[model samples]
Target: MTHNLQNDLLVRAAFSRPTERPPVWMMRQAGRFMKEYWDIKNRYSFLEMCKTPEIAADVTMLPVDLLGIDAAILFSDILVTAEAMGGQLSFEQGVGPQFANPVRSRSDAEALQTDVVHKLQYVAEAIKVVKHRLQGSIPLIGFAGAPFTVLSYLVEGGSSKDFKRTKLLLHNEPELAHLILQKIADVTVDYLNMQISAGVDALQLFDSWALALAWDDYEAFAHRYNAYIFSKIDRGGVPVISFCKGSSVFAPLMATAKPDVVSVDWNADLRHVKDGLPEGIAVQGNLDPFVLYADKKVIKAKILQLFERMRGTDGFIFNLGHGIMPDIPFDNVRYAIDIVKEFRY
Candidate 1:
């Protein structure tokens, strides 16, 4: 239980502490892009892998061993919390995640349990397994979906293009939307704290659907709850990252939420977004995930460009703007990581 971290670069950079180099870790570092991951996936269903502590721990360590990254994020789905809150979740081969009972009404929303510690204890168990295996070599990141993103799934039933169902509910039943968001915020705080208690070094709140809303609507819904979660969580001095995919326009607003770091999506300029945020907050990414598909020369150039943009900054963590694409060549990812590790800024 004595965590003498061999490499605390990620943790230090997250806190805006000066470091020799920027730490690097991808979002979906442990996913289908690696043959080793598929080797495990072939043996267990996704849900099974998540629920089983040993399997989840192994998956969490994959990127660190295979790709030489600075962090190991726990291998668990954001929706597991939703399922634990009584949404009945399942996965399909190509269709992605499906919910047996989507929350579309006040009655449906009322059914979600607020006490998440007991229901989602598997995640905390998995975190302990990861920490023991990791031996404090590098940080372990734990995360959950921001309330609005989780609400998108609950209202739309799955992935959405327009989020029409969710938007309609937010507009037509404002009180209902608030009720659901409040419940989710409460659960998110407890669930995240449970992960921290089990020994995660940092946490990230992923609002993948934040881009769907205009700034005004985002403030009304996503920002409000994100701030609430930040306010309530017991962080114990660990850094909390607020990440809103494709919403660089809200960097200043995201800063207002007061997370230690704000992750930028690929569509934004890394330098521009960082400059926009307040002085104390650190910035995470902006490299397009598809940049890996290009040749080494291009990848190196792209990596160098990002480094140069963030050259003088204290808290830069090199990463793809989003998760690594499944088709991205494994060798290319390795080369990219090396480029990042080798660069001197």
Candidate 2:
């Protein structure tokens, strides 16, 4: 599935190999910040956009074409796996994703399906299309939600502020929580492997809600399942990235999973985090997304400051701490990418 890539900076940097400068890409680089995205988004339901290969490839190409990023991440939602696993998933304008039949009791947990890769074939189709569109110009990153985060969505029925139901399930029914987590981990392993088979250049596992758990709970529920998926996947030299909101605190634990890169939030110093990580494990991100809202001068200064701190470091990629917000100025995002691309080590 390899193609002659014009820019292998991302893959090289992911393996901690030397590069001309740190490769630049953001978490949600292809998302709503652009009028071009909304032009297409307005015509389809969010899921419609994700499931259609042509539309998904179109959306996946926006950042690469418009922003000149180092990579293109597949345009899809994490909870699509949940829906394929028998959750009645839905999204509202402001309510986000909701599962009509959430896993509540032991029976509910047991009823969830594990043989779901067949149902997710559209993702593979979309990947093929994205790769064709990329034409070996850059890499395409495939991703899935990490087990605990996907489980939280299934148990809570949607996004939550406190994750009270999820935590209570863990505290009140430890075995049940383990059962659900195992199912998710199994699906994730197969799902990621499917993406690799379909020809993604790299993978990223998003544990968007791992920060919600206490230390012990996180180890038991989050870390173990992520590690299991990492162990089972057939990566075939494709780099895998492990990311969570609390990576600044849990990166050491994350590195133990053997991910090629660990993406951290903006709370920690990028250089300090990189210094702490074991050698050969690359570090991506730690910039505040809100910084894009500042003036171009401020954005340039912040980008330069991060680059200065990371100078002489290998395996570093410049990116925002998290996904871009929808309302961020499109010009500002373009400007930010320009700033990162212009810098040199």
Most TM-score-accurate candidate = 2
Give each model a TM-score: 0.98, 0.99
TM-score of candidate 1 to 2 decimals: 0.98
The sequence of per-residue lDDT tens digits that candidate 1 reaches over residues 28-126 is: 899999999999999999999999999999999899899999888999998998998898898877788888899998899998898767988889899
TM-score of 2: 0.99
Model 1 error, position 150 (Å): 0.4
Q: How accurate is candidate 2 locally (lDDT)?
A: 0.93
> lDDT for each of the candidates?
0.90, 0.93
Clash counts for all predictions: 0, 0
User: CA RMSD for every model?
Assistant: 1.2, 0.9
